[model samples]
Target: MSTPASRPVTAPATALSGPGSPRPYQSYVYAYPHKTAYRPLEDRPALRALWAREPKDALSLYLHIPFCEVRCGFCNLFTRIGAPDELTGRYLDALDRQAVAVREALGDGTPVRFAAAAFGGGTPTFLTAAELERLCDIAEKRMGADLTAVPLSVETSPATATADRLAVLAERGTTRVSIGVQSFVDAEARAAVRPQRRADVEAALGRIREAGIPVLNIDLIYGIDGQTERTWLSSLDAALGWEPEELYLYPLYVRPLTGLGRLGAAGDAAWDEQRLRLYRAGRDHLLARGYEQVSMRMFRRRGAPPSASDDHACQTDGMIGLGCGARSYTSALHYSFDYAVDMGQIRRIIDDFTTTEDFSRAEVGRRVDEDEARRRHLLQSLLQAEGMDVAGYRERFGVVPAGHFSAELERFAARGWLDTAAAPGRLRLSPEGLAHSDALGPELFSPAVRAAMASYELK
Candidate 1:
């Protein structure tokens, strides 16, 4: 393992220029550029090697269901809208086959102990109750019955989450469900291309709770065109009224090829500073109502149930992303495959399984060294409300964070954006830091990593 080097006397500060600075905050837009570029699978050997190296108990599984009844204009995830019934049936067949193939590729002796399993997509509930049961049966067989105690989470749209679907999920050991309740107001919901009624949203929650599933997470979006502060506040109030175990507050991002992107280009959609102000207001409202800020975009009731604690950041301690288009990372190399339903690439990856061998040890070592310790700490730290644990950092990375990013840390500290304490040794963001957390990633990412990521083409 590499140790953190002592701080140099002089190191440049990498903090982002403030919102209105000449070097506008968008300058860091591609700081952590998408390495896969949404391309098809071409790296099966590396991915398999990563899975093999990961401590079995450290792995987590994510299954993506890409069929949605209606496409939200703001959504850019890999999902098929209005997919044919035959295609849905075929997709489930492919999923089962893929699960079996992964099991075989992982080999028999590898003791894979999953800590968490999540089903996300267009909507996992889009599958029929029987289809979901079959998929669960496959998972139990391949991933093992031992996962019964693990935290299994699934995401669903309110429209798809019927009582039957919830019951199927409960039978499959799912402990939590995340429903996309983008807004409580019907007009705003329809404008965002999510036509769920307020009554339907409440009804879904009532059913999930009645089914005895312990945790319910509601997803809310801010920064949508025509979304007013008053309307947004009302939505937040409605969400709080539901008392979900967790609340995910996300800002709408208009990705390049998404429907929202077209609207923006035509000058029909716009998100300005006022939208950001609304975000801050929403955050304050949630915090005032006793929701703990778990991440930049997530809030949860204090003392949330254990099941809800198995979030992406906490589970990042280790994850074994399976399925097409899933990314897996161990303590060493990071490897991913694209399964965005691109037919040609999927065929190529499936065929390559027979030809490709394990990744070279040297290659794995290179990636580990290339991953800057300070950058990783910052990435994980900013994601949590409690911020970075200095002692934990020293234990894991064998270095003091202050010694690693001394200059940048000092600069932020001086600006009163960062607060550090002794004894337990944790660094947390001050109020100003919380307000600017969205811009922290670009500043903390190493330039070399950013450059390298920018140069990689997905296809």
Candidate 2:
């Protein structure tokens, strides 16, 4: 197996333009310090040893299907173009092997109860109906994660969200189906290097409705090359037409190694302002239409069922990831197969993952120290609209977040980004702060983690 040479990921002093400025869209703090921060374990820890003391209750199961019909330009996710004919079958077989190994590692008598589950990747729907059924069986039978008892979400693309696949997902008790409709305008879609027509996207939406899934989430992108306020509103209106249970308005970020990155697309002050404007506009539009703001990117209809339960948070709750791209999380460490954006590197890693006979040890990961865990808990909690529970933080870490992150909190409060007055027991973000979440998230990363992630092998 080959990996890229290491290089520190520290940004130049000049890159940080002070806390007052709207920093460039550098990162989205989605799943706690990203997989880039993870490195090969010098001594691969046995699964049984690593998870021996971790909580079995409130676990989340994530299945990664790293295959897509077409690669989106702006996307830097660890997924490859469509799998060849027999490759899908082999991949599922490998997944089954991994699941069996993981379940066994949980200990024969331990009862691991999963509170939530998700199928994400290049696209979960890329698999055939039969293949999807097998995927469900692996989750339910091999891993023993009850699908019907918990909330299950699956991601899909228009081309792959076929009727047959939807049928299998619906029958298997999928509560939420998030479809990537990036944009309703054909021009914007083409500009993003994700080719799809309005008619085709509409058809896919219709099919998803026909599948009888309870919740529908439509994802749209803002700040494309030629996207304007009018076009953005049009896309917003189109999404609202379905009265989707949830809507995610993502700001376009041209990251390194992505198709847009190769072209060196818009990454300037003007573009940032445009994206911010569009985001606010979209947020307000959704709110006016009876959608509640979950975060800067997510808005849900008031009456819609939640995407995940109130009790389960991926950062706090343990997760078992089941594919090459998936990252399994324990309280102390996050582990997964090597991460790569290049197609050749991804294929190599996937090939290794599929051929591996031993699935009892972790190959790549970073140890999450106590401080880092606190930072992660604060980040995961504060980023959401509901905010962090001060008493809960104290209960877990024996200190309040405000005192722990005093300097950062002071800066955010001084800048009017933190709403401390609203809830004495919670630490939440102000509207302005949520709007600049990308910039704020990176600021909270510990220096060591920043350097490690910066030094990660991109290819």
TM-scores for candidates 1 onward, in order: 0.81, 0.96
Per-residue CA lDDT of model 1 for 1-459, tens digit only, reads 000010001112233345432111222121122333222334434345555655564456766666678767766555556545365566666666656666665555666666677777667788889888876876778656334677888888777889898898987788888888888988888777677799988988888888888888888887766889999999999988878888877666554445665576322113436556777898899889888886666788888786633433431345544443344455655544433233344345434432434322112111434245456656667546678777777776677877677876776677666755523577887666655555555556576655644554432
Taken over the whole model, the C-alpha lDDT of each candidate is: 0.61, 0.83
Q: Supply the TM-score for candidate 2.
A: 0.96
lDDT of 2 at 42: 92
